[model samples]
Target: MTSPRRTFAIISHPDAGKTTLTEKLLVAGGAIHLAGEVKARGANRRARSDWMKIEQQRGISVTSSVMTFERAFDDLGVITFNLLDTPGHEDFSEDTYRTLTAVDSAVMVIDAARGIEAQTRKLFEVCRLRSVPIITFVNKVDREGRPVFELLDEIADMLALDVAPMSWPIGMGGEFEGVLDLETGGVSRPEGDSRNFQGKVDTDVTLPERFAEEVELAQAGYAEFDAEAYRNGDLTPVYFGSALKDFGVAELIDALARHAPAPRPQPAEPAPIAPEADEVTGFVFKVQANMDPNHRDRIAFMRLCSGTFKRGMKLTPTGHGKPIAVHSPILFFAQNREVADEAFPGDIIGIPNHGTLRVGDTLSERADIRFTGLPNFAPEILRRVALKDPTKTKQLRKALDDMAEEGVTQVFYPEIGSNWIVGVVGQLQLEVLISRLEAEYKVAAGLEPAPFDTARWVTGDAGDLKAFADLNRGAMAKDRDGNPVFLAKSAWEIGYVADRYPKVRFNATRER
Candidate 1:
């Protein structure tokens, strides 16, 4: 029998100590030797999970990366954990939403001082929409922060989640003695100048009398930690500690191993797919290209939904409707990878391909089954590409097409001319586009202001669409998939055109 898999994603706002917590979790699981090894140590060392020249230089994760590691539970034996770390920037909401679909649960990391942030609430809503249960980690407790009860109340009021405190901090900042282990009724604190946290409750060391009273009140304040309520998405168990200080890292891992759900059924067309179903089914949530500059490789990250998958098995992707043998299915530890001989449900496997597999595509043993719910929203920011050297026009187009396939940006060709327009969801994407063009494609390019402010995928009766397009041919374009799109100069223009053609649908979102 296969080891139970716990696939989850870590969602938080940028600079919420999420990256530190991720490295610490990997260290606690014995996936990597030192936390410093997984994270960049000095100025030159790159964090193992973070790549991309722009990401390294800017110190932000712009793309979703996967790291798989296993931990042995005394009762459950060895549990394989697939950790999907998402970009916390609001600019990457599209990517974040898609990543959430692939995970059974999520860890909501909150800054201790900054209780709830805009991006954090947005991502939490995404999880709530899918009823994806969450585990809350109130990070940075070692430093001074908002009162513990206040943070809990804010979580309860803002996100409307029943917040349960699994672990409590003693005193904060200079008065910071240590963290009280609620499970053991003991305290664990940093030792010596090195500040090495033992991550174990010292039975001999008792908590201060006043701190003990506070702990008693904290326990009685919120709803008790109920496993069923958590799994059902009604409540979230909270843990407080500083991720950078390596505090509560072991406890967080233990919480995940003990409470996180195994492979859950996936939402699909016709019917939901059960994990125990005998057919191999998975969906491509992300398609990344040029991870290896040397080979210019393209790998599709697939979240296996059901059945056992073995290398060299033929699976039909809905994108092409043709069965292809997956000869080199790879498992990831951040950027590092190894060819996987076999995988089970909830395991994320990478299938290296040229371009047949795409984001939102479903792969299955049969050609008929198609997974649902992964959709691309229309881009909010649109710009035109001006090349420094027009000689690399063909290469630029290929590069843009590749990036569009990765869902980083959307490229549309004007039906009337060869001029291309690129659309992105955020301003940061514009920076990424220019940076990637220069660094990855060796194409010096600059983005110029385009006339269009927004785009919509048009659908309806062919005659109605044809008439509308003919009337507004100047604003008409087609996406990379040849799907007709209506580019509007402003939100007002969309309403005007939308009123003109009631029969035609100008969709803000389109499912691939």
Candidate 2:
């Protein structure tokens, strides 16, 4: 039998301590001895998940990271954890959205001081739409924060997620002692200073001696936590901790093993897939370019939904229907990777991409089912990319194609022009693209403001879409996937086109 598996992503608003929580969880799982801070100064000491040079310089995650580790728990034995650490910044939310399609559940980190932020709400709605089970972590309790009750209420009110306390904070700020395990009813305090707390949690210790008054006050106002509701996804079990101090992290891991569901069935186009199916099946949710600077390699990250993946197995990609060798399957720990012999359901594996695979493409041994729900949101910002050196035009085009294939940004070709128009979620993305062009591809590029501020996909009958595209050739383009799109200068332009073309539908996102 397969070991219990929990594949989840960690999500939060920017500066909510999501990266710190990711490091602590890896530390708790014994993947690494010491958890490095995201902003560590030393050349060799940085957060494992933030491996990219740009990420290290900016001190923010710009790309999604895949990490897999195994831990032995007292109740659940050895379980494999495939943790997808996603970017919290809204500018890179398109990356986060794609990563969410590859995970079974998510761990949403909420800053106790600032409850229910914009990015948090956006990511939560994505999870809710997929019915992904969520476990909340109330982070940065080592500092003064809002009342726990109020924070919980805010999550319930803003995100519509019910709250269940798995572990309650003893106190906040300077008086911060530790967390009380509600199931065991024991207070576990940090043994040392805020910088390092290495002692084992003494669950046998009673709360009265250390936090008698605080616990009493907390219990007086706290309502009963329903464990059943938590498991049902109706209520998210909340764990409070200072991730920087490593307090209550172990408890969070334990709760995840005990409560989080394991390798649930996934919805596919033709049918839903069970975890224990006989044949192997999976879908590519992410494609990354230039992971290795020397080779300029591309990797397709696939989430195995059913059966087993074997080395050198030939499986048919859903759309192509041609057998492709599953060559050199790899698993990731930050930037480091190892050849994988076999992988089970709920496992993420990377296959070498030679321009053959794409995001939302499915692969299987005996089925032609496609997985749904991977989306391409309309780009809010548009720009035209220009190469500094005209001699490197081929290199520039290749780099743009690679990045566009990775879903880093959307690339569109005008109906009548040879120039490429870039569509991005924010100005920062365009900057990042230009930076990557210089750093990774050794080509300097610049962006000029385009006439369009918004882009929408043209969806309707083939004839109608063609007529619209032909009529507005200058303002019309095709995306990387060859989908027709209309670039509009303003809301009035979008309305004008919509009113004129009654048969055509303008969509903010492309349906899978």
Model 2: lDDT equals 0.80
**TM-score, structure 2 vs. true:** 0.91
Model 2 agreement with the true structure over 1-512: per-residue lDDT tens digits? 54499899998888888888888888888887777783445776677888767888888888899999889977668999999999888888888888988887789998877878777888888778777788888888767678766777787776576655566565431243334334344444455322211122234444545455544444454444565666566877777887887877787787777777788788887889888988899989888888888888899999999898899999788779688998799999888899999999999999997989888888999657878888888888999887788999889878888888777788888887767899989777887798789989999878887888889988999998888888898999888778888999987899998999999999998844
TM-score for all models, in order of appearance? 0.93, 0.91
**Deviating ranges (above 4 Å) for candidate 1:** 1-3, 37-40, 173-205
What range of 10 consecutive residues in model 1 has the weakest lDDT sum? 192-201
Tens digit per residue, CA lDDT, model 1, 86-205: 888888888888999899999999988778988888888988977899999989777667877778888888768788888766553223334434345444344432221222323444
Q: Please list all clashing residue pairs in model 1, or write none if there are none.
A: none
Model 1 TM-score, all chains together: 0.93
Winning model by lDDT: 1
Model 2 residue 510 CA deviation (Å) reads 1.4
Listed per model in order, the count of residue pairs whose N, CA or C atoms clash below 3 Å is 0, 0
Per TM-score, the best of the predicted structures is: 1
For all predictions, the C-alpha RMSD in Å is 3.5, 4.1
